[model samples]
Target chain A: MAKPLILVTNDDGITAPGVRTLIHIMKKIGDVIVVAPDSPQSGMGHAITLDSTLYAEKLTIDEESEGIVEYSCSGTPADCVKLALQELMERKPDICVSGINHGSNSSINVIYSGTMSAAIEAGIEGIPAIGFSLCDYKWEADFSQAKEYVQTIVEQALQHGIPKGTVLNVNIPKLTKDELKGIKVCRQARANWKEKFDKRKNPMGKDYYWLTGEFELLDQGEDTDEWALANGYISVVPTQFDLTAHHAVQELNSWNF
Target chain B: MAKPLILVTNDDGITAPGVRTLIHIMKKIGDVIVVAPDSPQSGMGHAITLDSTLYAEKLTIDEESEGIVEYSCSGTPADCVKLALQELMERKPDICVSGINHGSNSSINVIYSGTMSAAIEAGIEGIPAIGFSLCDYKWEADFSQAKEYVQTIVEQALQHGIPKGTVLNVNIPKLTKDELKGIKVCRQARANWKEKFDKRKNPMGKDYYWLTGEFELLDQGEDTDEWALANGYISVVPTQFDLTAHHAVQELNSWNF
Candidate 1:
């Protein structure tokens, strides 16, 4: 049997520890190809470069990465996937995996996530996809602890293709492999950010602000992704790109326009 | 009764003709305050400025905008909403309206729309919101045809209040008011872009690419937003920021991971 081809990408730049670990893990399962942003695209959602030009350069990141194909792209996470599927790759990949991100993308973060955007982009193209993230946000955070679990999930996804019209958003808790219980499938938790912009002045007396926030959890559901991650389990949320609220369509139809 | 305070924004920047026209119409319905990006932010899906500082200036675009408070912010559409809700506005707005966008955000385009991002951001903040877009992509696109329909929807939304956990995404076809049919409550059409990157070389022999795509509609459903727009009717899809695929949860749970 021919080896299944896997496309690897992330919101963090290709040099980030998180994606480097992801590329290493994916290589064990199938033929590996990496096309990711040259800079971090943390909260870029599903953004694509329309008004600007994109550059993709093939490079060797390390001595061990000589045989693996990697392209550092000057675009968002979504743009990397689009360029790869449309132009870079010779044939369609069996699956696309994004992240092993430097931070959590659980609950409400999924909407603002560049990590999940790449996975969602591949899912839209009818390829099985998954986005993995660690609960830690530090650049030097431990990713070695997630190797076995990440590999298992990727193997399973390739074995049983993800359901159509959806991608997997996987978030791992900041716990040792021994302390980490296992994986659980859950729905996204309802939440929002309490944003506060830090106001400052420039030398010219111009007002500038830096955005900061605290995550506010609004749901108490045990079946939510938040609950799973909080309980030391890897949370796999089946995420979709379809923006429609199917349940509300009926009620809205009765209204006169 | 006191007039409702309406917040207006768009991805096409604060001064685009589409948003300018939106401000004029919204002013008639309520007290209008505008907070939009300082430059065009097309295809900027849900992006928020995290690693940089943002500058928001209280600017008056013209003499006609004297009394109405408007701020031009150096950020994405979602960032503008966050700034307005968190810092700029003195009080919580009654409703948030985005766009009268210059192009179609009818189906798959919704996932990549900065217009809808502002509305979704407001929705996450527990505010009733709606995003409006014209199927025409011209800067000088005739927005006069959408005046009556836009006002009716906004008024209806304020009176009835949108359902909890949802925002409205309305797309108007490129047609005169006479040729335009009425509004229709619809689901987002299932579609994808057949993206092709135009590759070229620079003087230094380095390659740069321009991204372009053609919309490919795959659904035959008559109740979709694409169907509505094609039939000369305005389409209103109840959009949600929650990315969870509820139906696929049970299936994923059965997987061994």
Candidate 2:
């Protein structure tokens, strides 16, 4: 039997250690193809390059590595997935995976995440997809501790198949393999960033602002992603692209229009 | 009685006729504050300017207008809302209304809409919010026909607070007042773009591609936004930001992790 085709991409650019680790692990499971952004697109959300031209080029990242195809695109994470699926790939991929991102995308952060956006884009195209991230947000953060658990989740997803209209947002707690707890399928924690603008003046003496924020978790539910991460467990939240608030539709219908 | 404070914004820039129309109508309803992008930011999704500094300046678009203050920001639509709530507004706004957008944001397009993203951002910030869009994409699309309906919806929303964790996505068909059947509160239609990359060679001999698509509606449900629009009715879909697929959690839990 032919090995399952796996498409790999990330928001942290092609050379990031996080995605490099993800590619290495995916190679153990299937034929791997990597199409990712040429630069960091950390908070790009689901943005597509509509007003500009997109350029994608084949790149040989690791000369010694065999049976791996890679390309980098001048666009957002979502754009990379769209370009790959609609133009690059000859056959539909068995599964698409995005990230081992440098930071967490467990709760409200998912709304602004380029990593999850790529996975969600694949899900929109009816592909089984997962986005993996670590709790740490450092350039040199270790991804080794996540390798075994990442393999486990990917293997399980391949076996059982992801639910329709949904994709997995897997955020691993930054801990040693021995210190890590098991995986927990959870809901997104109700949380938000308490935004604070760090005001500063540019060289021209004009006031400018830098967006900084503190994550404020509003839910203490044990079944939430935040709670699971705090308890040393990896959190897998099944994220969906259907933004309709179905419960609110009935009430809205009562309004006089 | 103190009038409701309505925060107005759009992705079509501050000078666009769509937003100008929105401001004109909103001024009749409440104290209006406009915080919109300085230039067109269509298809920006939920992006925020993290790697760059943000600048906002007070602008005098209509100096003769009373009870209205406007500012233009060098950021995405979501960033404008964040700045308004965090830095600009003296108090929490009673409600936020985005767009009078020059195009549609129904169905799957909501995921890629800067107009809806602003409304969703305000919702995340615990404010009642709505985003209005016209089906016509032309710059000079007539917004006069939408005035009465826009007023009705805003008045209704102000009277009955929006549902928690949700915002309103309102799309108007490009029709005269007499031609519009009515308004319909409905679910987002299941649909997707059939993407086609128009590959071309640049002047410098580099291969580039332009992303284009055709909307393909997969659902024939009469209770969907698409149906409402097709029948000459305005469509209102209650949009939410919590992307968790709650129903899929149980099934995913059954997987071996």
RMSD per candidate (Å) reads: 0.8, 1.0
Q: Pick the DockQ winner.
A: 1
Which residue pairs show backbone clashes in model 2?
none
**Residue lDDT tens for model 1, A1-257:** 78999999999999999999998888888899999999999999989999999999999898766799999999999999999999899999999999989999999999899999999999999999999999999999999988999999999998888989999999999998899999999999999999999999999999999999999999999999999999989999999988799999988887779
Task: Please give the DockQ score of every candidate, comma-separated.
Answer: 0.90, 0.89
Q: Least accurate stretch of 10 residues (summed lDDT) in model 2 chain B?
A: B59-68
* lDDT on C-alpha atoms for all candidate structures: 0.94, 0.93
Decoy 1 TM-score against native:
0.99
Task: Kindly list the per-residue Cα lDDT of model 2 for residues B12-97, writing each as its tens digit.
Answer: 99989899999999888989999999999898889988889999998878654555788899999999999999999999999999
Docking class of 1: high
lDDT by residue (A51-82, candidate 2, tens digit) is 89999999877753456889899999999999
- lDDT tens digits, residues B65-146, model 1? 7799999999999999999998999999999999989999989999999999999999999999999999999999999988
Against the native chain B, each candidate's TM-score is: 0.99, 0.98
In model 1, pairs of residues that clash are none
- Give the Å error, residue A93, model 1: 0.4
